[model samples]
Target: MTDHAQEQEMEIEALEAILMDDFKEIDPSESGVSTTNRCFQITLSPQEDDLDASNYTPVQLALIFSHTEKYPDEPPLLNVKSIRGIKTDDLNMLQEKLEGEAYESLGMSMIYTLATSAKEWLHEKYGQNVLDEVVEEPASTKDDIIIPHGEPVTTETFLAWRERFEAELALERAKLMPESALTAPKDKRLTGRQWFESGRAAAKGPTTVPEDSEEEEEIDFDDDFEDDDDEMLEHYLAQKSEKSAEESKN
Candidate 1:
């Protein structure tokens, strides 16, 4: 294969790794697909205290990636295949923002950038404060107004929303507590400190030492001892006792 072809393959691999690592909302299968004709769906949900939590529902978007035969030399195409629970205006805004990103990031890895831009747009447009104040009036057409236009609230939706809200609340509470108090495990898994220390050590570099070598280092301590100071102390004490006895007799 040519150098350009090799570079394109590397770019695709980089994109795949990024999606797998950073975009946890994308499924494993979806992230593993070939980048030649990449298409996948991703879901974005707001944090519990997001301004529009009252009308918040998860937004799903289908992403399509197109790359030229000379990929890294040319910018990839990112188009939204489908979007649910987002208004047409918001969808258009997201597309515009993505197009701007693609143009700005020409000759660079743009797939991850495009996906992150879309996520930001979703949060800005859908995760805003829509129910800030009570407006008094219009009792007749109150039912006609939809806070979030597309999706209706059902049992399943409510349960999903409640679960997300509670999880976010727990996370916030955890943040407020002292680090020592946040030691309880939510599941049978590594503790937070263990995870952090492992990650830190990994970042620092390799830290493997042979068991026998470590034991040898631990046992190599000095064993010699001296008692000159003790002898000196005893002589000083005997002299002091003689002086005190002579003083008492006088």
Candidate 2:
């Protein structure tokens, strides 16, 4: 595949994976598309087995935003069709962003926004039920059950932990990020150097140990006779000093 095609495929696949595993609550399949709990609904048209937004009706196009470019910050672009009644302000904003030579060259990001806007526009023009499909999950059975308490953490638990960690890391990252960078448009995200600096600052923060705390750590000496001998010598010297003082008094 060409670079454009490859990038599109990767984006689609990545979106599918995120929707299926993370957004299972959305039930993308209810709209006649095949999907797991992850919101990415796979569809087949004529000879093809997957969705191609270029082929979808204006309404069907809007639903694509549900899973594929689900985030408000990172939207997908659809090139095939345009919404009929987009607000003037929205249009102007989009035009301004598109006019940038930089955005024009970043075809993937541009396409993403197009696809995402198309999805939302479809829902607005059509109705919600237009995108709803029957969502069916497999019936649960005891066969897959290893008792939770007795078992090591399940895949779900590990995934949950990872998600929590990611969220915490994100909060820490945000804390370290320049306020200007944080408020900038999504496309104008922090550069690699900024990210590295923020990450280093984040990594260094909560993990720091205070000097007093370090000093308070009990010294762990070796369990050898040398320590015992040192203690004995100190006691002997103290006693000898006392006896010598008595002799001096005599």
Root-mean-square deviation per candidate: 32.2, 31.0
- Which candidate tops lDDT? 1
lDDT (tens digit, per residue) of candidate 1 on 1-250: 3466667667667765755532323433454334545334444443333434325445555555656666655666555534456666666677777777788887766676777777666657655543333355756564443556777666788999999997876564444344554665667444433443444345458746787684433321122114423333444466568889999999
Error of 2 at 231 (Å): 99
lDDT of 2 by residue, 81-151 (tens): 12333345644544344334223444343433443443454345443443343245878775576555766
Error of 1 at 177 (Å): 61
lDDT at position 66, candidate 2: 35
Residue pair clashes in candidate 1? 52-128
Highest TM-score: give the candidate number: 1
